[model samples]
Target: MKKVAIVQSNYIPWKGYFDLIASVDEFIIYDDMQYTRRDWRNRNRIKTPQGAQWLTVPVKVKGKFLQSIRDTEIEDSSWAEAHWRSLTLNYRRAPYFEEVAEIVEPLYRNCGDLALSQLNRKFLEAICRYLSIQTSITNSWDYDLLEGKTERLAALCEQAGGTEYVSGPSAKNYLDPVVFKETGIELTWFEYGVYPTYPQLWGDFIHEVTILDLLFNCGKDARDFMKYTK
Candidate 1:
């Protein structure tokens, strides 16, 4: 049975994000949804010597509170250099830092003036490839989107020929199971259970940081620490 997952694109998301992508047959970037400020949509955490630090992509949010994620533009191109500097300064000592930097540094250097959704997709695709995740990635706008929260998700799964829908556990609060039952699609909650600790650089390991942490520390063997990725 084909499994599908619909989630908003995130900037340098954590391992669990990629885990979700790898768990599915088709992973849809649901960027058509409204953009939320200070969310994973444009920012994420990175481990540092002091503590977890945020690496946020500054976006133009003034007078545009209701813009979709696909329409959210980057506020300044300088944010790229700044973010790259943070990654380098913090993860320079990581075991595989140089190897991972070869793959990620260029993405930052040439980020250019792109929408937040596009930027997030670029990083997501790169990380997926690094871990050999072959899941088919698509945009939400590619489908004829319907109305209602659960209705839209269930319909999208159906349109994608999905026999099962895999969603993050957060949706348990609002996702209506009846919708999936009517569509004959089994809705399953994805659990970000206790992940195995890797050779992290920092004193205390933090899994909430970006997947870059895993890449910088483990390089080609990163998949061994991840759940769904082969």
Candidate 2:
């Protein structure tokens, strides 16, 4: 059966995002949804000496609520350089710094004012490439389907020729199982349970930070590390 997963594009998302991508045959970037402030749409956590800190990308909002991710724009281009420096200083001593640096440093140099969704999609692609994930990824807008939560998602899955849709745990609350069944599709839920582990840092490994923390400390072993808990 054709399997697919749908998720909103996140900036430097957590390890679970990669897990979902690896688990599915096709990963659909649901970027057509509304953007929210102080959400994963443009920021994520990273490990720091001070503890877990947020790395945020400024966004320009037209109104109180984001109508769509496509309408959200990056507010400051300078933040990219600052964020790069912060990551460099924190992870310079990491085992995989050199390898990941070569892959991530160019992102800062290529920064420009773009939509939050677009920037995140690019970052997601970079992370997938670095980890050698072969899943085919596509954006929701490319489907040319209907809009709205249920209709949009169901139509997108159909357009992609997906018979099964894997969704985040939160989707369980709103998604009607019967609706998906009627559409000739199966709904599967993904729940990521990340166990705490020591990273290559000062002392006492932190948890729930961005996937960068996992990459920096575990390096090439990050993939294996994730599999242990699963």
Candidate 3:
């Protein structure tokens, strides 16, 4: 049975994102949706000396609807440099710092004011390659799907020749199981639970940071560690 998973692109998302992708046959990047402010699109948590710190990407908003993640303009280019420096300083002692740095440093340097969606896609691809994921990754826009949540999602599955659809836990609230069943497609849900122990930089470990944190500290073990929630 062919399985598919859909999710919005997040900036250097958590290990759970990659975990879901790795578990699926085809991973769809749901970038056609509206951009939410103060969300994972622009910001994510990271470990720091004091405590958790938020690493945020600034976006330029024009109007609604027409706004696409591909159109999001970074507010400050210098932020990327600062972020690179911060990660280097914080994770320099990490066992996989050099490896992670080699992958991430160029991302920081090359990302000189680009679209949010483009940036996220690049990051996602990099992470997937690093983790040796074999699933096919695609974008929603590539299908030219119609508007509306259910319609677009169903259409995407059909376009991809997917007979089964997997969704994040959030879909449980509104997505009707019968609707998908009627469409001759089976809907499965996956819940992302947190890992009990992740690699620590300096202080007590912080969870839910970008996947980079996991890769930097845990190295190859990060992939297997992410599979276990508890």
Candidate 4:
């Protein structure tokens, strides 16, 4: 009864993202697809004294055409330091900032990787450890990728030895149920809705900020807030 999820790598994504990871037995970094700009692939939000702000990593795909997420490259080495500084500046006062910082700060400083997917995976794996999520994660490129939308996803799940597929809500758009049914695999959808708010600093609590907001504010208990028993 193995459950699997496949999603593009996101840069320090929101708590909901981690919740999906925690819910499954295997989580696949499906970054072999085309990269989209102004998406969570390279940027995410963090709360500030004034309001929410985006911390984005500049990529070198402006002139290049049809770059896959795994192939996307960071424009320069400076984004890491700047992003780390921004996080420290805004979240320095958070209740558990220092705790999470000690574990995550070195990632920013030591990032010599050029690929966006590699960097995203680095941060994601580190944060998953901090949250104690032990789900087995692998890259999609490691598998024999097929063509088409749902077919590729289903192929990846099957390659990962998954009996059930847990997908994000947006997959309802083009995910063909017939494919799963014919393949004798169960397909389930998970939505990150109405997240319970925890004690947050700065101002009114914002729910969609990066999971770092939850980690900095809730510390080790952040997992309790992000996941449910049911």
Candidate 2 residue pairs in backbone clash: none
Model 3 bad stretches (over 4 Å): 62-66, 228-230
Clashes of each: 0, 0, 0, 0
RMSD (CA, Å), candidate 2 to true, equals 2.0
Model 4: weakest 10-residue lDDT segment is: 221-230
Error of 4 at 23 (Å): 0.4
Candidate 3 lDDT (Cα, 0 to 1): 0.81
**lDDT per model vs. reference:** 0.93, 0.81, 0.81, 0.90
Off by over 4 Å in 2: 62-64, 194-198, 228-230
lDDT of candidate 3 over 1-230, digit per residue (tens): 88888888899898888888988899998877778777898777777787778888878774554576655667778789878887887778889989878888999899876788888888988878888888899988778686667767877887888899989898888777776777788898887775668658768766778888888887777877877221
Clash list (residue pairs), candidate 3:
none
88-207 per-residue lDDT for model 2 (tens digits): 988999999888888788877886766788788777888888787888998877888675677678778888999998888998778878778889998888878755575558556666
Tell me the tens digit of each residue's lDDT in model 1 across 1-230: 99999999999999999999999999999999999987899999998889999999999999998999999999999999999999999999988999989889999999888889999999999888888999999999999999999999999999999999999999999999999999999999999999999999878978899999999989979899989886
lDDT of 4 at 192: 81
The C-alpha TM-scores of every prediction are 0.98, 0.93, 0.92, 0.97
Which segments of candidate 4 are over 4 A away from where they belong?
A: 228-230
RMSD of each candidate relative to the true structure: 0.8, 2.0, 2.2, 1.3
Ranking under TM-score, best-scoring first?
1, 4, 2, 3
